[model samples]
Target: MQPYGDVDSTLRAIAGRAEGFGRHAIGGLHGALYLVTSLSDDGPGSLREGCRRQEPLWIVFEVSGTIHLSSYLSVSSNKTVDGRGQRVKLTGKGLRLKECENIIICNLEFEGGRGHDVDGIQIKPNSRNIWIDRCSLRDYDDGLIDITRQSTDITVSRCYFAQHDKTMLIGADPTHVGDRCIRVTIHHCFFDGTNQRQPRLRFGKVHLYNNYTRNWKVYAICASVEAQIYSQCNIYEAGDKKKAYEFYTEKAADKEEAKSGIIISEGDMLLNGAQPCLLTEYKESVFHPSEYYSTWTMEPATHSLREVIQLCTGWQSLCRPVDNMVMN
Candidate 1:
């Protein structure tokens, strides 16, 4: 089987065996299974109701359909919205996690979200220990994912983000210095021809590794407002006719001043483009090697980033089960 074929088969098999497979095993998190049986706006068995309940729960969609949300779904702590084994999409509005902890969101699709604060997923204000995995997000009004207001310990992995402007924003406002404590890990994701701000960071320790990026319009990664970013072992492929500016950009309040932003890049492969402006020479100050933000170590990527990301990204057709089980 081909690479994507293998991934599709494995994902389908896992989804078919257990609707809530791997929901409890993420980052050692354990929760009760809550089945979502309706595509309704509210009431029992709806996704909104499942998220409304303040408990440690794994919310699983038993049906394959689109849920056009009337408003942003506010998710509480200790919850996992798992859309495995089903084709579930959230349109019109997105999910919001504020002051929450220990959350897992996986195998979902978010698109065409418009209007005020219309992001794919908005993590706001003190939210921690979040894992957003294997999802597809695009065409949102604002950002695909915005981690702001001191959110920390977040990981976005094996996801696909495409055809969107302002894909990700870490730390809402540049003046909000409270974001210094934010720590995020982005791995094995695919950023495909995103216009700009694949992520514009501010005052956070962000680790971006083993990701694949292609044809970025403006820039790939921007470190601003004293962000400490370590981008390592990633692959970048520029599109024909498009000038791929050195992948990294610095946006400091005072570019002339010393020690504005800290960015460390190692072993990143650039194809059909020139090497990015080395962060070491651009920034006056950088983070110390001894800084301990995450337990995960920064290591060299073993496999081809192109192959790995192609197999793991976007919405797989295998997610739509043959039975189309609807729990009601």
Candidate 2:
């Protein structure tokens, strides 16, 4: 009935089914259905072929297996890679969402990505109106997901991230002041026992809520170079690093301003010696989701939140039983 309804929702879902800044995203809702009949890296029936097409396509898998990409699968605009009723995984290079718009990727697994600058989903250089939901990502050479170079209006919801360093990076680096327009929403995700960058932000507006981040090697969240993060109702289970949030100073490119990020923590559960620095004492300008979006699922953070994320997050099977009588 609604968009981005909590976890296990259709990724970017069925038109009008995304939450947060990417609520307006519609990924090939009216496009022709393109069946991925093969698991090859590239072919007529392969996933890569459908993705590279110019026209809008709703890509679905007729067969299920691992697709080992030799190179990045660059997706075009108005595309929805819907992995429902099947199991699909990417093993080699990952999906590249470079300067595309109105794209949705859901119900896929990503792991074992090698090489430099390789990410599970890389959205950059002004890509907008994107949603990545219900995916399992880990063990990559670079970040699981990265949004940089002024990319904005994206949402990463109901995903499971683990067993990786540098989980997610918001901005490219401290130099690009144009990253100030970046806006993203992360909700109802499980950040289970990952390293830093759950994610690390540079300059952008981030609305993080209802997430479970636990047993992190580095800090759970970081703010650098004038980032604004609004963290709410999140469960942070501390590990060796008790401090869940970290703030560091970095010069903004060539500017002399020693600008760092600011995080506003509200109704959060900081367990297992999570330091109080998370409740940033002196605050500047912060972006609240209510100020922009009117409708979104808001649930209080509780210990039960763990079970919700663990169960509802990641890829799922949405297949229906066949009626044999219909064939007769």
Best TM-score among the predictions, by candidate number: 2
- How many clashes would you count in candidate 2? 2
Q: Write the per-residue lDDT of candidate 1 for residues 1-328, one digit (tens) a residue.
A: 1112232343222221111111222321345567799999799899999888886676778788999998999998878777877888999999999888767787899999989778999999998878787899999999999999998878777789998989999977655778888888787789988877767788787777778878887777777767777777777777752333323334434345433456677777777763464556754355532354323334454445588678868665545333222333
In angstroms, the error of model 1 at 195 is: 0.8
Best by lDDT: 2
| Clash pairs for candidate 1 | none
Model 1: lowest-lDDT 10 consecutive positions: 16-25
lDDT of 2 by residue, 104-205 (tens): 898899999999998998998889999998899999999999999999999999899999999999998888989989999999899999989999999899
Scored by Cα lDDT, where does model 1 land?
A: 0.72
Task: Give candidate 1's TM-score.
Answer: 0.81
lDDT of each: 0.72, 0.86
